[model samples]
Target: MSNMLLTVEQAAEELKVHPKTVLRYIREGRLQATRIGKAYRIDRAKLDAFAGVASGRTRPPHGVRATVIVEIPALTTEAAERMATFLGAAALGGDAETRPLHFNTAFDPTSGDLKIVLVAAPSDAARLLELIELQLGLSR
Candidate 1:
């Protein structure tokens, strides 16, 4: 057990149970959680302690991280600017599982060609895309 933060879903995956089950544990005061706004963050140490008490052995917390890169082309200047701004903000405001996001932009005003490069951890990639889509009003 170490000082690691995991979401309820991740904890549930580690415990081989549903996320709702994790929530139930939290509600029942069986699992320790830190409520962050609407979500719950579980500590790795506490999770391992709980597991040891439950199963008579401690299980190591899973810590796997992946880097992901995504590129978008044919974006308008306004859209590219918005995406860049959002990426910058998101990088600064990563949650428990999210890593820093890196963004690169190449825009040619004369040719109206805009290319955006997004680098982020896998856990945060989906969220980054959702934000991009929301900001740009794009379906992709």
Candidate 2:
């Protein structure tokens, strides 16, 4: 019985809610708990069920959305700058009013790999890729 029971404070911590909220749930019959003397004891299973419901652990409303992380190899400072400008332009075309997309550029002289990471919406991902291909002469 002790193992299956949790105190109000413990349940509140597990649920990430205030102790008062737990008490309110108990009073409102939202949570199934027992009054032991002056303390409230909640069943572990019931607490878990309530947590799943309150946290909306159900399936996503719609289908899953995909995010693409495009990486471009930049060999020189000029190439890196060009990649940055291309990504900036794509982000502007996609959503200029909103926050700009994130762009990361790193040059490894030893490896001779200039890396650029562009994080943007799926719709804008193709434009960015096309720009990189055009810059690198990879596309005919």
Candidate 3:
């Protein structure tokens, strides 16, 4: 069952449900999936398991995993404090709808030098960087 992979829409169609519902199931750990970029690829076998079936599936094609680094240059003391606060809220804001990417941040209290690392597929790196830039008001 691992060989066959289905997108969220395809899986939702197979189960006769909305795509958001399918995403919800994934979030609640009811359905199994491997996140690809901003999307998810569900294994056919896991789908069967989810449906209480016993079919073994095969692996699907996967994209190259990559990392993106966002180097936030040293900031003024006040701006650094603000950035820290923003990061705290950003983490809290992520929930079921967030991407399956991994994130790590290194912050310097005295120097105000910050570095953010995001792990995702190669294709998603740009979008993730855009999001981070927007959050930091760099777009303006």
Candidate 4:
């Protein structure tokens, strides 16, 4: 079989689903694709993998237990700015744009630390914690 890459629309057509459904699959981690800049190019094999044509199941590699949301309060303007940059970088690095994820920041004068909330897959919670530690200079 030719290992041709397909767009979301094409994949949706083949799967008899809507483009949004394909997007949802990508967001939910039920499908995998190659990121070409801002676009996702999925190969035929990957599409088959997602459809369970080969695997017989469309579940994530592991079960997701819960979603984690973290809050950090910013005490200083400098810290807040730094945290914002770090969060953006981390999101990009984590490919969160194509995954089930939400990242946001807020300020609280009453608290002394930067506040960030990350709602993500349970498997990624540990990575989020590691990012928090790195942000707090607690981990290298």
What are the RMSD figures for all models against the true structure?
13.6, 17.2, 12.4, 7.8
- The segments of candidate 2 whose C-alpha lies over 4 angstroms from its true place after superposition are 1-74, 95-100
Listed in order, each prediction's TM-score against the native is 0.42, 0.42, 0.43, 0.46
lDDT of 1 by residue, 3-62 (tens): 889999999999999999999878755577899999999988667655543333333466
State the lDDT of candidate 2 residue by residue for 1-140, as single tens digits: 32389999999999899999999877755577899999999877667555543223354466233355545543666666666565544543431123234456676765657666666544455666777788788997
Query: Which runs of model 3 end up more than 4 angstroms from their true locations?
Result: 1-59, 76-99
**Selected candidate, larger TM-score, 1 vs 3:** 3
* lDDT value, candidate 1, whole model: 0.67
| C-alpha lDDT score of every prediction, in listed order | 0.67, 0.64, 0.67, 0.67
Candidate 1: residue 34 Cα off by (Å) = 27
Reference-based TM-score, model 1? 0.42
Q: Could you tell me the lDDT of residue 58 within candidate 3?
A: 38
TM-score of 2: 0.42
Backbone clashes for every candidate come to 0, 1, 9, 6
What is the clash tally of candidate 3? Answer: 9
> Which lDDT tens digits does candidate 3 get at residues 1-140?
25699999999998889999999878755577899999999888666556544343332356366887777877776776565455444433333323344556777767778887767656566666766678778885
Best TM-score among the predictions, by candidate number: 4
- Which segments of model 4 are wrong by more than 4 Å? 1-65, 95-98
What candidate 1 gets wrong by more than 4 Å, as runs, is: 1-74, 95-98
